[model samples]
Target: MSNHELGTVQVYTGNGKGKTTASLGLALRALGHNFRVCVIQFMKGSSEYGEYKALEKFENATVHLMGRDTFVNKEAPEVEDVELAQEGYEKARESMISGKYDIVILDEVNVALDFHLIEVEQVLELMDIKPKNVELVLTGRNADKEVVKRADLVSEIKEVKHHFQKGIPSRKGVEH
Candidate 1:
């Protein structure tokens, strides 16, 4: 029962919360099954997040933060943001092809695409070349239509209700 038999493309996207959380949950579940996972965070560049600290306990999981800690202006992203995302995408593509990991998560990559930090064509190309044995997960808001069409499983989280709407700020271990 190897995890490498029929890996598929999964996309978690929308305006709702938990897209990243859902992807992380999948990584944890995969790790529980002794699968190696690699998570490439496109627009997060800090170790301050709780998931960053918690995932350290799993030797089979690796996380790469590839952006500044500050916010990115979607209308006009900084050069650093673009560069980091490009670097992260390159690493993710390499990992997918390396066959060293059973699951590869490109966290916030959809947002990166929506904000024009990276092109959809490149992402689509990566998906095209992805090895059949490597599960690919892409997460973030505003996932492109083409990406959705390409994914084997697409989950669009709808924000029917959220604590943030009630003015509750993002809490550690819950929203980080």
Candidate 2:
């Protein structure tokens, strides 16, 4: 597995928006270069991301979405949502091991781990077990430092100012 030139694993973390967007951008760029891309979106069930929709038109990209439409919170956590996220990660791990994709985005995986539905140790183990050529990405706020340390690039999107805090609800195409 170490024989091939390894790709990078990145962390897109912080309180601001666009964590998944950043990863999607990477996927898009990879796809442009004829790289096969796979995205496993956690915390998102039937809803669609515009990037996913666009990528679906291409023959090279595939998206596996798992989750219900619900927000995560400390007070009233979505137990089922987190469970589904864990299941998605299990499938994601399988895909990573299979070496079918040039790049794989485990979108919102960090959030699932933070909620205690997914084990951080298990993810770390999976990282070690991944195919070297498959560039992996884990996105969401509050990414573990251990995970970040293991990443080749770590970008934290600090929320200096956001329209959401200004009472702006999430809009289609923009937020989706």
Candidate 3:
């Protein structure tokens, strides 16, 4: 078994970018230390992301992509979107309790919760039941207040300015 210390719930949320990036950075750090890591991405199905390709190279890391490549409609999400989010949640819960992973990153899970693809109560319960040794990281915008309250560390990445404001489209390897 890994010798990592007890893990705490960390929430990275805001209207700005870098929530996923921050969690992935943590994943990379954990992997560098030879810790088992599981990343279950909610509302993100495309394998084209650069992080997916990079993380795949690590034998100790498992990345599960959940959702379609298309954007989810926040006002009226498709039934399939909901299904995928639920599946992702189940996978995350299992990963946390299985004792196989030292770090579990639920990518875009906050967005999933905000869009009503998954219930806040469910996420709260998952936090409660998380194994003491497994670090749980939740990322995305519009994080619920309750989640923020319960998290051991909350980082709000506010966007003071972004390239998108300058009419610059998402650049390859930078935004993606």
Q: Number of clashing residue pairs in every model?
A: 0, 0, 0
lDDT (Cα, tens digit) per residue for candidate 2, span 96-175: 87767888899988888787768889779767887778898999998988998888899999988999778999887898
Tell me the TM-score of each prediction against the true structure.
0.96, 0.90, 0.98
Mind sharing the TM-score for model 1? 0.96
Answer with 2 or 3, whichever has the higher lDDT.
3
**Collision pairs in model 1:** none
By lDDT: ranked, best first: 3, 1, 2
Q: Write model 1 residue lDDT over 91-151, tens digit each, in one string.
A: 9989899878899999999999998999999899889999888899999989999999989
lDDT of each: 0.91, 0.82, 0.94
Query: Which parts of model 3 have CA positions greater than 4 angstroms off?
Result: none
Query: Which regions of candidate 2 fall more than 4 Å away from where they truly are?
Result: 1-4, 73-79
Lowest-lDDT window of 10 residues in candidate 3? Answer: 1-10
Number of the top candidate by TM-score? 3
Give lDDT tens digits, candidate 3, residues 35-103. 999999999899999999999999999999999999999999999999999999999989999989999
